[model samples]
Target: MSVYTQLTNDQFATFCQSFGVSFVRAIPITQGIKNSNWFIQTTDDVDGAYSYVLTLFEERPPADIEKMAVILNQLDGKLPVAAPLSVIESNSVQTDDDDKRYVIHYEDKAITLVPCLAGSHPEQTTQAMCHDIGAALAMLHETLQALQPAEQYGVPLYPWADVRDREMQFMPGDEAKLMSDIWRSYTELPLTTLPNGLCHLDMFADNTLWNLQKGEEHLTGLLDFTEVSVEHYVMDIAITINDFCTTWGMAEQGESVNFDRSKMAAFLQGYESKRALGLDEKRALPVMLAKAAVIFWLLRLNVIHYNRTEGRTGDNIMVKNPDLMKRLAAYHWAHVEKSQNTVFVLSGTTSDNQIIGVFSSITQAEQAREKLSNSSEFAIKEYTLDQLS
Candidate 1:
């Protein structure tokens, strides 16, 4: 609920006129954390009705917003993302630009408008819904392949280092130490080999709107592209799985967060339905989970530390409990390096065959699988159990 800049109806009407969209009424959208948003109900010259989300980009740099517009432009027709609308030309007819500011100045802040995709965020995220979002994300990642990765398209890692250097005020000492440990181990992961590309790093349920149906799930609207960036796809996967699949009631701020393993499997299956996850990706996922946890932990902490007076008046701030992320980070870090893998030997042509035995490590599992790969009509595979259930 961050609306740092306010606009009057007359001001909004003038702004809408530039885009050849008439302003009917405006309602402030206060669900977002980073930027100020408003649902503008508009009427064209012909009395045609439409709605758009007007966003004043805060926190992020102007250049990042430019690249974000480019990404949204590329994904306009391919996915359910709410892309920004261009301002009508001086003639008030056609509007086109290559790399100009689709973003305009409002109170010296960069702002843009996008069509409001219709759908409500699910009250309770179903396994089927998780599956739908997983596939949608993969499709989004696939379509985003066309865009070149740029510096501003990613959240820089150096900030983590800076965050570490800052003196702790409210954070528990042991929790802070655990976070440092995870970040240290995260840097040692095989980051170079993992699939890296443009990712919607933040895919929590609220960011997505769904077409809800009995025994069916459909993704209708994907919002808040501000957090999209260039990063390892597995990291994105980890972030989504943690947010969507995990559901324990918020007892306090962050006390009851728990990951559901069945939903995790279902989500991975759905993701693989569009794009396959390789063994390298699988192996790196645990640490990537830790990385996702740390990133969000630091992000929330940074926000709370800086914007202390965010929601003191009208609306309450949706402060995501950093402790929950901290807890998950420590959990993943503990399991990531554990020596717990199982080797499987298959009969016939199917992968659902027989597990030979549980090996202590992936290396040992590989050795056992290799010994039987040459056996008469048998397939071999290694499955790492990076403890998440």
Candidate 2:
């Protein structure tokens, strides 16, 4: 939502008139990183004033943008999504032959107008907010289940997969290996059997709006559907949890990162209130959390890389620190390990039926027992985590 492209007032007024309204003014919205966004004000005889968000497709292809617009239209009344306003007449390549939904062509790019939603971006998150977001996310997925896979909609699946190899070329060996290891763990999961649907892969706090003016705060809108994709339900849940449950700090300040268990519980409970999660999804949450962190780490690095290589330096260009995500990935992995390490002890006749070793995961404990020479008499003694839960 940066002002990458500058447009004259007259040019904007002409565009506004195409929608049958007179443009009052336009203000650049410089909060996001991907596209050029503006808060546009228009007026008509019937309505004195009205506001809308104008977005120019900066990086995404025109085809993908159209699909996103259609998706928003489909989800508008159900969710607080900003559905694109249809053009009165076809001005550009028609998005659909039977439908009047169209995007204006501007310099070989697409532009869209959507209603400016109420409320402001929340500065901080609470358990109530997390709960509300979780229920909303579940509703989104459930509603999207009727649509076909992302490929049918011309949307990419697992967007980060396209840039992983290229981004690794620029990463340090340690960071690259960390990324690969976590990614490998995620791929090894039973993803094919897990529940599948379109996911709001980016559900950060700022991407949502809340009615802070009222005594009771509630979510009023969900913004930025650019990162939507077809993926496992657990992966989406993990991505949302990574942002909502984690406490972040400025990378320059070297503050510590922490995850709030209570917030996570509330989010899960809220999600369960709408739709129950499968056992496989429950088991995959820990590693999926780590995987989600890696994706964002890669995204931040990609943004920084392009900003330097493409000479896109400006106050309007918002570049987040990649180090914070790197630290977050490490924290998630450690948390997974800590949760997995339930002190599994291997006993076998080879060691006179005594304890042989302690392991974190069940697979690691089984592998250790297989390595023993006299494995037939071996038995694995697992410690119960009755207190932790």
Candidate 3:
């Protein structure tokens, strides 16, 4: 991510020696917010100039870093993962005795060197690219099915409660309520029935690399597995769709964000080509999309909070706008209400109360409630098809 720990070129050159490469240059990459990254250039006798990405883990523990390295290694040939280069065993003599196979310790921080992937991050996403990414993501999920359990790798579940207590509490009343509503909607879904596996939670276009050829863009690489964890497949899909299928800066036109349905369809088509989604996952998608947006909104807000309180400031620190994500979350909820695909069940408060009527639209359910006796209180409960199951 961002350049938090500054390193001199001489320091970089010294570090690169362990990998048996002559360091040419180390340029700070100032795009992300989690770790410190550098675009390193190295010279070899056979390959004059080759590029690699040098990453310095700013916050992760050694075990976390090691797990990431192992995961990347597992996915290396199967996908275009940026697998870290193993430290030359002979070079261990030059460094410390507590040597890792792929990772090195420098300045008490975990560091890794991965070959720079070819192609550039797509400036704009296309349907074809969406399809490719979706298919690739699905394939990635299937490939990791045989891997050990999430806990075995020390991968933690999504911190829904943590975000609610830490970030949402400090948010404005309206925004906090929106978050709570969306979270409740998500929690009510049949989450256990949804497919689960390793998921790249952050699959934004910028995290992927693409190459343009003959007017069509093809996915060349998928970058950044730092946020990868064991999560619902639908959750991963929702996160990806929120990014690839969303058009930013449309607030001036009217809506805060616009969802390109055609692109979303193409992406799902590609995903289904590799692995089909259960009907439950499809039904849960709308709410999950809103939930995904809320998570990112809170994440960005958290970043801003730390940057201000922790006093992390510099040209290398890149902070994304949280308001955009908040607006997107609102738009998703509006979309859900307007679509009216969810079922509404109306019931009375009496002890002998039974399900009176199930309506497709909330308006219809409200009308039915109005016609009923006002003496017995009524409540409209929303449910997705999966929830009924």
Q: Which segments of model 1 are wrong by more than 4 Å?
A: 44-50, 92-101, 149-158, 167-170, 251-255, 309-316, 337-389
In angstroms, the error of model 1 at 147 is 1.4
Ranking by lDDT: 3, 2, 1
- State in Å the error of residue 2, model 3: 1.7
| Least well predicted 10-residue stretch by lDDT in candidate 3 | 91-100
For every candidate, C-alpha RMSD to the true structure in Å: 6.1, 9.3, 10.3
lDDT of 2 by residue, 1-389 (tens): 67788899998887776655568888889987788988887764234334788888787777777888777877778989888777766456546644765577789888888888988887667788878899999988888776675556536764677678988887789888888888898888888889877888889887898898645888899998877777788888988988888877655657557777667767877787798888788778879989989988888878877888888977889877777788888877776666565666777756467887865544345545655677667777767566653
The local lDDT score (0 to 100) that residue 275 gets in candidate 3 is 94
Candidate 2 local Cα displacement, residue 328, angstroms: 1.1
- Candidates' lDDT values, in order? 0.72, 0.78, 0.80
- Candidate 3, residues 199-230: lDDT per residue as tens digits? 88999988998887746788888888877788
Candidate 2: count the clashes. Answer: 0
Clashes of each: 0, 0, 0
